[model samples]
Target: MALRVRVAPSKVVLQNLITCLILFYFVYYVSLSMCCLILQVYELDVLAPFDFKTNPSWLNTNYKVLLFSTEVTYFVCGLLFALVVEEWVWDYAISVTILHVAITSTVMLEFPLTSHWWAALGAGLISMICGGQTLAYCLFKDNFIYPDLGNF
Candidate 1:
């Protein structure tokens, strides 16, 4: 005798939800990075530790760039955790990113005013929503599901 198997629609919905979240963040990651590289300017160190350094404004720009790639990788990791390992990373990592951004803006870079604030706000909202959804899905009482991160 053969046993019959069935799949639920929730699983498909969950997969799409995860993909959308990843895509949303990925786009944000790219935009922020490009803004830094192009809109902002930086200068390499004239003569310090033979290190390339730039102005605070430039540093801000580079930071966006770094965040873009870092976010991409992190999201990818989350994706893998979902797919292969069936895991969700809803820990300090996300909070750390937010905190670091806040801290650096306050302590180091001269924050961009006007439009940038609006942009940041939007980004924050989106992140919160995505993070919240991911958390909700992870903790859902009815079911537990994790995705296999598609491709690298």
Candidate 2:
């Protein structure tokens, strides 16, 4: 048995990664702003996305809504990623999530310890990958579903 691997040129890989990261963050922040305005939660802090202490406190209705809205934005960010990136969709998506967590921990001066926070982050990661992959599959179904007979 033999295993085969395909490697893209470093320059092209880096370009795709940079494009994915930029597009993901840009769409995320824009959606966050829209969520704030639509939910009338202007008091929500800009750093809420990274703040571990900002977990969805169900007792506080506004805070809960704000957190939920943030999750939705994460899913949308994933969709945008799929629409933009063509190859290594999973790799780019996971990389973006790790970078987000790293930045969040750095800014907060500590890692997120709460289950709610982790759960939210996990949900966001899952949503991004699943949604992105699903959309990517749909968008590139021909490649996935049909073999290139020309090569054979």
Candidate 3:
């Protein structure tokens, strides 16, 4: 007699599970940033309870650039997430380069250009979220929780 193991219902779903989680994290990042920016603009003091001052110099930049760059970054990330797969081609490589340039230029422009702490706060929080997601992915790899895409 030979021992046997049951297989998953769908191989594609299993293969793309990690990618789906990454895409979800990216979506959550954009939504969270928008909410934070809205609250900060109205001076709602959403973070008043904790009053955590995460004033990283790189985040504070010209209001217009901060807003536009963050929005563009979100868009670019969404596009890139859609392109996730086993093999990345030239287009993905180029887009990644562009994203890096956009973020770097805007961050460096913080000192000479105008600065908005609120925008910085929103962007910084998103960065932290991304960092956490990255850490989780690194630690868990394929074992991390992933939803079943077949139901949807």
Ranking of candidates on TM-score, top first = 2, 1, 3
lDDT of each: 0.44, 0.74, 0.43
Q: What is the lDDT of candidate 3?
A: 0.43
Tell me the deviation in Å of residue 121 in model 1. Answer: 6.1
- Compose the digit string of candidate 3's lDDT tens values, residues 43-138: 323322112233434454323333444444444443444345323222232343344444445655432222444444346435534544454456
Worst 10 residues of 3 by lDDT: 44-53
Clashing pairs in 1: 43-53, 43-54, 45-53, 82-147, 83-147, 83-148, 83-149, 84-148
> How many angstroms is residue 40 displaced in model 3 relative to the true structure, after the best TM-score fit?
29
List residue ranges in candidate 2 displaced over 4 A.
1-8, 144-152
- Predicted structure 3, TM vs. truth: 0.26
TM-score of each: 0.29, 0.78, 0.26
lDDT of 1 by residue, 1-152 (tens): 99998768778556545554555455544544454556553442212111112232435655345444344444443443334323233432344345434544665455434454334444544554465447556655346665578874
- Candidate ordering by lDDT (highest first): 2, 1, 3
Clashing pairs in 2: none
Error of 3 at 103 (Å): 29
